[model samples]
Target: MGLSPSKRVDAALRRAPAFAAACDDAFDRCLADAQGAFRGVRLYQLADAAARLHASLRASVPLVRRWVPSPPPRARVDAALRAAGLEGEAELSRAQLGEFAAELFREAVLAGAAGIVGVGVAARAAPAVVGRVVAVYAAGAAAALYLSLG
Candidate 1:
């Protein structure tokens, strides 16, 4: 069987340092600037799907303007990630990252390329985004774990 959700989140937290650093460098102000578009788990999952791209400098989102596009639809994200073998994964190998990155960038470009970053800032902020999601996710998971144990 798969791990409990709490265990899974904790595991992700253990591997969260690098992504967290990226968040520190970019997401805080931008999250507010997104005007609630990037809040909570939506932001988290976007990063999860784009984990590979976020790590690379090519996808780094620089906060300059006040407006940001909305993230892509989520209905197909899980299925696509599963097909990519990335669903629920905390860490990814370089080869896997390349495959996922190309797919995500392609989709993001197709979805919205409003000159935000030559593709679209909305779906492209995973590197600048996931750390906050991890923090929020881990906090929620910890609460769930505590309540369950208590």
Candidate 2:
């Protein structure tokens, strides 16, 4: 059998450093693209995504805080959000944070798929990948519910 729900989350947390690095690289690329596109609107969107992702990571994987010695990448992302004019207001609630985590999971899956497929992964493929990733999270949540109800 596969790992339990909590185990899955634990495994994911163990992988957080690598994931965070990949996310930062992706976010930087997106920011560059955004800056070139619409006078930084795209950059702001990316910054928001980065912030939401950071917050979700913080919530889901508390071990991450101890893993890093210096200012973490997520903190830098949050700083970027403030610099982008999204300060003093939490842009994402709990539900939104969950959604952002799902999205990040999806992006990681898609990136891996693209590497395996050896082809260009289109932006349109994101939603489908995200759906699949969210389904995994849903299953884990369901398992937690079953355990709690037991």
Candidate 3:
């Protein structure tokens, strides 16, 4: 059976560190490509770019039971673009689309990258701390056993 929605989120969170580098690269490329097409592009090109951005993020997540699960990447990208002053228009200028892509990439990298690093740090630290605690407890139990025997 597939993982529950919550479990899928947890899996994404847990594995984000591994996928983060590629995600960053993809977003960076998207930003750069958008910037290059800074003038005289068709409307479909802009929409295509947005769609591609969504697909890239969707593909980045390791276990893909759904096209997109919770924390919807496409919605987040659109929201980020809107926040950056992209109105919901049927047609947009090349510069506008570039700006939208740039904003989306910037927000995604900023939020997701920071989170991945924080999670990575915590995940690594937790095991070491747990190992030390386990070791100390084992040592104490062994000493107690020795005392009882004596």
Candidate 4:
């Protein structure tokens, strides 16, 4: 039998925390690399770095949600996006923001999984297990970042 929508969402939330953690780790690595590659950069360069980071996080958010399936509270999602630097004068509805957050989570999960596999760690594990593990880690990272910032 197919899972109920709420049940599926609940399953996804369980994975969210891990995905969040993986995402944070990925961001930390990316920032470190960027800094190393561009030492003593100007203010504009720093701004550019910040922009890239924001874009990366935004893109990853949807992936993590898709892979891990965390149906966060609408208010939480909105607050997260805002904290992550998504800005607009217009009011965003809960549904819209929720969808965005879900998508972002999925994206992050996929990216995290890919990263793990790319580094040759996934070869030792079954594909399904690897995917699930990656989802959990990424979701956790994302949740930590969200809670800390939001």
- The prediction achieving the highest lDDT against the true structure is 3
Q: List the candidates' TM-scores in order.
A: 0.28, 0.26, 0.35, 0.25
Give the best candidate by TM-score.
Answer: 3
**Could you tell which candidate, 1 or 3, scores higher by lDDT?**
3
The better-scoring model by lDDT among 3 and 4 is 3
Return the clash pairs for model 2, or none: none
Superposing all C-alpha atoms, what RMSD in Å does each candidate have to the true structure? 19.1, 13.5, 17.0, 14.0
Model 3 segments more than 4 A misplaced: 1-48, 51-72, 117-150
Error of 2 at 9 (Å): 2.9
Off by over 4 Å in 4: 1-11, 14-91, 117-150
lDDT, residue 150, candidate 1? 36
Per-residue alpha-carbon lDDT of model 2 for 83-136, expressed as tens digits? 434444433333333334434443332232223222214334566676675567
Overall local distance difference test of candidate 4: 0.43
The whole-model lDDT of each prediction reads 0.41, 0.43, 0.48, 0.43
Per-residue lDDT of candidate 3, residues 1-150 (tens digit): 855333334444335543454434444455466685633333334444555645655566433212233333656656855776755564455445545654554445334423433454567767666566556655654344333223
- Ranking 2 against 4 by TM-score, winner: 2
Q: What is the RMSD of candidate 4? A: 14.0
